[model samples]
Target: MSLRRRILILVAVVCVLAGVAGLSFLRAADRAEQRGRTQAGGPEIARGGLSLTPGEDGPRIVFRNMAWGPNRDELASVPAAAPEGARTASGVSCLRFHSAGGTGICLQAVKGGVQDGYRAVVLDARLREVSAHRLAGIPTRARVSPGGLRVAWTVFVGGDSYAGTNFSTRTSVLDLGTGRLDASLEDFTILKDGKEFRNADVNFWGVTFVADERTFYATMATGGRTHLVRGNLAARSVTVLRENVECPSLSPDGKRLVFKKRVEGLPAEAPWRLHALDLTSGTETPLAEERSVDDQVVWRDDRTVVYSLPGDFGADLYAVPADGSGAPARLMASALAPAFLG
Candidate 1:
């Protein structure tokens, strides 16, 4: 054997080993940063009524129709030194009505690492929280009709099993005063190849109920892209409405929908945005054109649309016109889902 040849082979082997080690190191670093993003708190909070609810315990309803902005003194008294004031310089991320005698309960994030955890506060008609409770799983994003006859939220069981957590979004209904589930969140079936694909984890969360309480809509994901599923409360069945969407936010009149669509061939920051869909026309329009716009929007009226925007200290809240006319206004900062109270 030649010593020179043996030395050259050794050098080649060392070079290959170093390259492999370097690649492994780079991959590990990348995974570390990605894992750090546990959805504990991110743009999702800001996109939804980020500043609506007091605590980050879970789902929150926005008090959008409480006459006007939140009263600082009244809010301070109930939550007492909450880092982000309820609909302060920032806005909230959720909107829902109180069930009957129960005060309006809204969703908010308490802190970081709270994926399915949020705080629910009892708010009076004046938009003041009478009390608060810590919610575990993501509360079904829901809305109550003007008549206050029905309350609806989505439900999913097997979806929770992901990420070592059982996170499911189910649609639940409640009567006004009783405050009990009028009808538990049922399941959805997929008619594929003439067979029923009954999956417990339907990935259903966002829900919108019409005034009639018989028909509502939600969002579901199939084959990586998302779709809208309209389910009739009476029949308990769902049909695909739209595709390539993430979350669908229904309008107050139930005539229009604002949602986040998966913009393919675009940058990652553009996966979600503010989009409006006409139920009767099936026409989609881009309203708030922001690369970073996220869903969880609530309709203050037929014209005003409110969603959360993330900011320093925490996520903030922002609002824009649903008619696609006015510029986005920052209603408050450091908040999540803002539910309305009329």
Candidate 2:
């Protein structure tokens, strides 16, 4: 072959290989960008090539843009509005905003560890701390009512281990509008099967308020069974509604309740399945998320539910269809105990 022809053929082969490598690199970059856009809620620009960008406005990213932060307008359809200046308190374990007012309530551990006590901190719309109550247990959950007039929380106490059998919880409610605090639900009168019942072992947690703000639902455990109990703040009374229901979360419309039902024969560790119960008809519909959900569930809207699971990095939040129609989708990485701020 002529030397010039040989040289031209070699150069052509090199160009083809370079083109292929460039195409491969571009494809990989596109895949990475796609993943980032979906996972982080980051922006995506598609000009000649795809690029990942920051979200212009959404949920006002906080905690160094942590994944568990609620997105913008996430609870717009729901009755509540996100509390302003909610993220000002550092090391918050659980938080919730009222539906209509600027009041925000959160539980922050003194430190990141469970041995340290928690602080139930109230923040105004400007994110300034208004009041704080020193609590004696590890922070577990915090919730605010639709009108921001009421606050509820649960903390784990006297636990040998975080997941140990000896662990107990203390649940409390505060009527912010009236400045009345029910320091503990254990003092309330318990009604089981329409009769007054008293037991020292009775425990309550996971309180979800209804529209009336006077009535709420919570999980009560006694006699080795967990029951869903409806309570009235005015009367200081609780009546068991159904058995095997833990961590009841009321739907936005107040017509249904979502809770975790303990499954038998799983192992030493109790496995719970998410179930939705009709408050009127007493029919229970199991949610599509089959994994063992140990945390209290929250309603994103009327049609969707969100919860958290422990992950390698941190706690992660997930969303599942309320009607058991779809698989769970990861909503935030390293987020647990999510509350909607509309």
Q: Which candidate wins on TM-score? A: 2
Residue-level error in angstroms, candidate 2, position 329: 1.0
Candidate 1 residue spans exceeding 4 A from truth:
1-103, 107-136, 139-142, 153-171, 175-197, 267-270
| Residue 35 C-alpha lDDT in model 2 | 41
Can you write out model 2's per-residue Cα lDDT over 1-342, one digit (the tens) per residue? 999999999999999999999999989867755443323433221112100111133332221113322222111111123222222223223433322245666676576565666678776554457678877687776777776678888787766322334778888898887778898999999999989999877878888898898999998988767889999999999999889888888888999988888777765575788998988898999999988888778787799888877764455668899887899987655444555544
User: What local lDDT does model 1 show for residue 242?
Assistant: 62
Worst 10 residues of 2 by lDDT: 45-54
Q: For candidate 1, lDDT tens digit of each residue in 271-331? A: 5667788889988887764645654677766887777655653455677877667678776
> How do the predictions measure up, each by TM-score?
0.57, 0.72
Model 2: residues with Cα > 4 Å off, grouped in runs: 1-100, 111-116, 160-164
| Native-referenced Cα lDDT, model 1 | 0.53
lDDT of each: 0.53, 0.67
